[model samples]
Target: MRLAKYLSHCGVCSRRQASRLIEAAEVTVNGHPANHIDHVTEADHILVSGQLVEGPAPKQLYMYHKPVGIDCKLRPDDPSSLSHYLPPGERVYPIGRLDKDSHGLLLLTNDGELCNRLIHPKHHQEKEYRVVVDRPFDAQFCDRMSAGVPVDGVITQACRVEPVAADTFTIVLRQGLNRQIRKMARYCGYRVVDLYRVRIANLKLDPQVLPAGHFQPIAMTELKLEEEEK
Candidate 1:
């Protein structure tokens, strides 16, 4: 593959952006500097500028219950931070993100391809959240959220919203839009008292063992599903 294409596939950036970085003389191949948009092989030593251009690391997956107040960054700028609270060593990024104020089950991984597939707008993987609101819940509101609310320019996909209590509801969504739940609630004039994501596809929090601000390794076999009928 061309060096720029290789960089793009590795989640570095797009081919054009890679070319710009290369032309800026910030990229290198092996120990030597690189300046041209040449084809590069897996065996070739490549780098952006002085840093070595090794391929992205092998994919890794973990489940973490992110507590409120922590930003979803691999390297947080805050000295007193929750990511800093993670075990030291290899860098892992969140597969998707949960807003800083929300708490829930979050997946952390280095697998860019899997991350892209799960988060890319098309798949619409299912996610479940337990939400607490400031006032009593309404069946009508639940119906509207399930029926899809128009926000921005598009309508939300029809979803599953069931009341679990007088003041809370369990919402299952297949979309990952930014602050989507909050936006939908705003449309209905509900103030969320608490928001916690409880499920992602085949994985759900262990009600018996899981807790906030901790993590557990996930088995690859669970995710290694064979291709099947769509």
Candidate 2:
């Protein structure tokens, strides 16, 4: 039987957390609450949330250039979306989310394993963006953001904020928090005029490539890096 190790291999969670989930009765075997923490092999039927646990899907990956005024992500309340913007195929979820008001490079994939690995807090995938604010940039604001900014009672992770123009900067983050740049700008007394993600890991969107509402297949090299992260 495949043990909880299989879950870790699938990047569902770290091995330690996987064991805890197993013990906490969050797993199932043949539609029954699977109480055992051992033997997670394929010999036994295993699932989490009614979905098969270890089998792989036909991995599909794409890079979508999200444009401003268009939400690249799916939301129940938002009446429009980029889902209709993608080429026809199996459904894919964003590897990490970008605010609808902000546009940039977004990765969509059906590989849940890589998605789990990339989004998991510990993996620390680097997300880089180009930000334009209405007000002039200040050195002090960059310093504060790089150190840490208090938001929602939690200090955000250290970031690499580099000035690209008098009114623009490149913000690189290891942590993907919801509307983090917008919140950071507000805290810094700047109005975010335009924002776009330029890079995720080694996958860089080509210069002015893939216009808004359009997507293209991603390279296998990028997928390999995500799969191997511990």
Candidate 3:
């Protein structure tokens, strides 16, 4: 395969971005600067920015209950990062992100294609959250949220909003904007005190089985994800 395509398969970046990296003279093949966008066979050695770009690592997918205060960045050196919580030497990235303040089921994996599929808005993957707010929850709050509310100049898409208590509700969103649920609540004149994502796509967080800061390997078939490496 072409070097850029191989880089994409390594989860480095898309082929276009890989080409840009190559153009910048950041890629090397067999310890020498690579000048051509050439094909790389199994016998050839490739590197990008000093990092080896070999065959894809073993594909792994984990259901992680990210506790509050841990940021969803793949920084192994940062003690507060989600990567710090994983088993040692297991390099993976979050499929999508949960802000530092939020907690719950986050999918982490080495499979870039699966991550792209799940995070792409076109898939309409459902993400459900349990939210606690400062104001008393009312039908109007549910209606406005269900109908869609303006957040950062863009109105949110229609979603399922079910009241769970006087001050809490369960929300299901097909779209993920930045701090989406929190922003939506603030737009509706409420302040979120706590936000917990309980589900993503077809998987739900079973707290009793997988508690906070804990993780478990889940079969790709459980997520209905194909095993294609790239």
Candidate 4:
């Protein structure tokens, strides 16, 4: 496995962070400073910051209801980072991201391969959100949004949009553009007052089960995933 993937499987950090650690000369393989981002073996001894890492840790996944104001990055040095909320010493990376101002169901996992597959837009994983706008939205807004909306110089793929209230609505999107829903609303002349995610893929957020800022383990068997053919 690559050094970064090995570090991630060891529950030490994400692949990106692992690369940074390697570039800073904080990692060593077999008692020698490691410089390459690739090439690591299960038999090779690994060390980070002068501490030995035994081997890959057990794979785990959790569904977390992230809170607003928490940056969705894994920076232990930053107190406000979302990774700080995870169990102490259990390093996991968010599959995608939610900006600091938006909160909802965020997936965390140590399985780097699964994380990559889930976030790839080609999978067309459905993400549902509850939105509140500053002003009342008519049926026309839902129609336009469901048809398609221009954002970031491209036409957004058609999504399911339904009005919940005069100022509230629900939307499901498969594309994870940067601040997508907010940008779509803005283009339609509406200002979003609040946005919360409620679902991702097959996982649905049950507030009574896991409230905001809380998380729980999810079984792989619960999700029927197709294994890629070699």
Q: The CA-based lDDT of model 2 is what?
A: 0.73
Candidate 2 regions exceeding 4 Å error are: 1-55, 72-78, 223-230
Residue 172 in candidate 2, Cα distance off native in Å: 0.7
**Cα miss at 226, model 4 (Å)?**
8.0
Q: For residue 16, what is the lDDT in candidate 3?
A: 52
Query: lDDT tens digits, residues 126-221, model 2?
Result: 888999999887899889878888777789998899997899999888787778888888888888988889988778877566776688986556
lDDT of 4 by residue, 71-187 (tens): 987676999998679855676778899989998899888876677566666677788999999999789999998898899999999999999899999999988999999999999
Q: How accurate is candidate 3 locally (lDDT)?
A: 0.82
- Native-referenced Cα lDDT, model 4: 0.84
Q: Please identify model 1 stretches exceeding 4 Å from their true place.
A: 2-39, 45-51, 80-83, 224-230
- What is the TM-score of each predicted model, taking all chains together? 0.79, 0.73, 0.84, 0.84
Mind giving the per-residue lDDT tens digits that candidate 3 earns over 1-230?
88877775676654555687799999988877776558887678888878877677777789998899998865667889876787556656788889999999999777766777787677777899999999797798899999998888888999999998999999999888999998898888898999999989789999999989898998888996323343
What is the C-alpha local distance difference test score of each model? 0.76, 0.73, 0.82, 0.84
Residue 28 alpha-carbon offset, candidate 3, angstroms: 4.5
Given candidate 4, what's the lDDT at residue 199?
Answer: 87
User: 2 or 3, which is superior by lDDT?
Assistant: 3
Model 2's TM-score against the true structure: 0.73
Q: What is the Å distance of residue 159 in model 3 from its true position?
A: 0.6
Error of model 1, residue 229, in angstroms: 8.5
Alpha-carbon shift of residue 35 in model 1 (angstroms): 10
| Model 1 lDDT on a 0 to 1 scale | 0.76
